[model samples]
Target: MTGTAPNRPEPPLIAEPLTLPGCLKIFPKVHRDERGRLVKTVHHETYSRYGLISSFREQFYSFSRRGVLRGLHVQLPPAEQHKLVACLQGEVLDVILDLRTDSPTYGQHELVPLDGERGAMVYMPPGIAHGFYACDDSLLLYHVTTQHAPAQDAGIHWNSVGISWPDSQPVLSERDRTFPSLAEFASPFRFHPEGSPL
Candidate 1:
């Protein structure tokens, strides 16, 4: 809610596909003026057209200093989530992994540049795991479709995958660092194609 110009009508969000199926790089419309800028991050009508989950059940953000890396995570079956993640105060090298066994891009990963200043976001389906490396002191916002379910929460170890992190010594939480590597993770989330919602 930092930037708001309610009187003006914002354009619809622009969605671009990433290498992985169901993963998208989104650019919400931003209006600028002599004072500053106004960003419209969500619109149910426009978002739903792209198959994004607009009825977010939870919304929060995280602040990370440079060299901090977080995630490669998702929830299990019956508690999976669709996410719209954005960087609101800095930039990050965002990473997304496709975990759907049936997906053509299964086990494939993609790198996206999320910038706070420019206002970019990523939309990921349930069968994907996401993580990021802060290139600056970044503030990341997360809008998830499902509430947190601790028992179903899970993740793959950061180093297990072949991602080339910007920092070899990124600050990590015990849980993120200790997650099972890609080879050890047994994914329970499944994918549905274009017209379907998982």
Candidate 2:
């Protein structure tokens, strides 16, 4: 005796809208089974197709428990760094701020909900502030265009950006807590008179 069944289709990758001054790049990975599925997180050639050419000099991974908040930071330029960020194990509410005084999106903010289950990557240009709230105990991995420069590192207070974060009094590190508010710090990157990157 045998039972009849209907075939199920695979779900397509979800690419969320890129808020101004922020971009989301999506790559489809082939899935095969019996053993385990394979997923390619990054491919230089594929990234080139999207006009991203900068090579990474450093890579970092951070693991945070739920309700933790990190960042709202940018490195001073010529030390400014570009980033390619992804969620590997759980989920995060990723937020970015356009800090270029001359950028059309200056002072504007964007939010991206990144999930490990949905292979998504965010491209953050230099002259922007980046941060995220751990929606669950999450693992975040990222590639940077420049090496870390402790002297040139700085950040804005996360609450100043106006993004509604998870309500349970976020756990913050001392450094993040001591960071200045956006209005108190002078931007280290130069923006054109037209509000664009110089």
Candidate 3:
């Protein structure tokens, strides 16, 4: 565990909605002490109030070096995921693309800067393509609503969505390089307007 678990749960932190539909940016309150700092990563009740009612079934974290870009990824249908992602060790330029066919913001993308020192996190709804650029040696913590399904794994090619990533060539896996371009993708997600359940 990075920060010691509190003896008693802390109060819920509020989140701000981003321009991208269904995406939210959260700044968790950090309590500092002589020992270090204590961060409350998730408060089920706080997230529930924000309509993120799904119970996370899995939690994972990843490490990336500067310039590494990891996605624009998604899973089809029954395997699609809703995620809460946080920076636990460094900073990243996180990006999201709306892939919902009925969304008015379909094809639009948003960029968010997350810093571990600030305890920042983002909530991504299923059907959006997500990726990040490591601004430093960074660690990301992820909480998701679904389990992994290799067969359902998919993505939009990182460079094809018009994101203005830093000019150095991004370090990418062969899989990320091979995903279809946004223009070439046939979206499978349908948009549920605000106030409707996803």
Candidate 4:
């Protein structure tokens, strides 16, 4: 008698230019069994093949309640980070702003609706600032190319960029509320048409 073959799972899907140059939205494949589910959020080879940063020196995560907004943040160059962000336990409205002064998309913004159950991920290139609004009690994970440096920390004011945030009064840390508006601040980052130094 012949035996039946085992099942094979499909690979994840990667959608590029989710809004800005080098930005990507990844839909990870989730395999479910009686035990639970398994997901492969990163494939180093695939990332490298697409010219996305694949080396992550640090990993961190955050938990936030609905109405909480974190960021509009980035590390200054010499320590700027390329991050892979994903929602792990709820939902969020993920946002990014292009701060590369010479790029055509500079000062532009984009939003990606992220849901933990779908396991989608966003790749944010070095010259962009990022933030998120919790749509529910949310958990977000980050794989970053550089370690955090207190002195290099910086951000643009969240409301200054004209983002249509869902909440009128978001709960914010004092620091997040204090960054200068984009127009008043001068960016040190310059867009490199060839590619960013990895």
Candidate 5:
């Protein structure tokens, strides 16, 4: 069983499967000594053995001041994206919504606390909508298989679903506020149990 979950105590990097069918919670190797710390965020071969091997075409950062709320967003097909996300500074209450109609967890959302000190990351396949709250001044790093496509950019309103975000009045942008609610938009992605990459 190469893609084992529940965290292996001996491996330097681990991917724990979440409730969502194709999502993963990744723990990277961290070295700590008198010299402080070093976090190794990714390694293709190790991730591959865990059923996660992405081309990762682009890398970007999202910096949020304390109390900022971002996303609940996704890209449409033809420009869909596979994402690897990590909060490298501060911490965040990260959430993801599964939109694949056939998935066991469709329409359900799961959350995990991504702390800078913990060095854990999240991997989301194409149809998943993602969002997070900056518990403190946080910096999130993202790796995606596709470049940003404005025309294909899409999202569900952060408050449309039943996510228990930590902030009652977090900062928001006009664009994020305008996305359709979960009940309003029709999903264009599907789940393939035989393992379509996303």
Candidate 6:
């Protein structure tokens, strides 16, 4: 005698919410059973429904312990990357900085609480700085439109932006610790240069 297969569950829809510099893009929530849980990071159709263009070229995942701070990082023009960052395991205080001098929100900031349970994602366009502090043991998954470029990568000191970071002595890598304050470095991204692609 042959046995019938069980029906599969459908993924939840992505949610977009308001933020200071850009929208908060979210992946669908996953339901679990005795077997396991399932989640989808990107669906072209769903992203399109929200006016998101551009293809994902690379994927990255980082794990951080509580009170760990990652970055206020961004790549320069010609290597600028748009990212979709989500918390997959725990919670974080995600922050973004608007670097577009021409943008109405220039020098603005946004903070959001992201976690595995919320399944929230942040979509950061080029010309913005992004960073986060792990509020709990956290796993962050990011999808990028461009591959990593060492020379083009740049950042501002986490404390330079006037945002209050929860960790006073957060652990940081040598590279992350070496970046100059926003005012100390010459920015590589311009809002309206004569030949810019924007």
Largest TM-score belongs to which candidate?
5
Pairs of colliding residues, candidate 5: 72-130
Worst 10 residues of 2 by lDDT: 189-198
Q: What do the candidate models score in CA lDDT, each in turn?
A: 0.86, 0.76, 0.86, 0.87, 0.88, 0.78
lDDT of 1: 0.86
lDDT by residue (31-98, candidate 5, tens digit) is: 98999788877787787787775678899999999999998899999999889999999999999999
Cα lDDT tens digits, model 6, 105-165, are: 7777788788887576787778888899999999999888999898888998888878888
lDDT of 1 by residue, 58-173 (tens): 99999999999999888887988889899998899999998998888888888898897789898888889999999999999999989999999899888887888888889999
Error (Å) of candidate 6 at residue 35 is 4.2
User: Which candidate would rank higher by TM-score, 5 or 6?
Assistant: 5
Best by lDDT: 5
* Residue-by-residue lDDT tens digits, candidate 2, 1-198: 458676765433323336654355554464768885555656675556455544999989999999999998788877888787888878999888888887777778888888887657777778878999999999998889999999889999988767888754799999999998888878866454342211
Candidates in descending lDDT order: 5, 4, 1, 3, 6, 2
TM-score per prediction, in order, is 0.91, 0.82, 0.90, 0.91, 0.91, 0.84
What ranges in model 4 sit over 4 Å off?
Answer: 1-9, 196-198
Q: Please write out the lDDT profile of model 3 over residues 10-91, one tens digit for every residue.
A: 5557688887778888878888889977788888878777787459889999999988999988888889888888998889
State residue 25's C-alpha deviation in candidate 1, in Å: 0.8
- Global lDDT of model 3: 0.86
Better of 4 and 5 by lDDT: 5
Model 4, TM vs. native:
0.91
Candidate 6, residue 30: how far the Cα is off, in Å: 2.6
170-195 in candidate 4: lDDT tens per residue?
Answer: 99999999999999878998777577
Q: Spell out the clash pairs found in candidate 6.
A: none
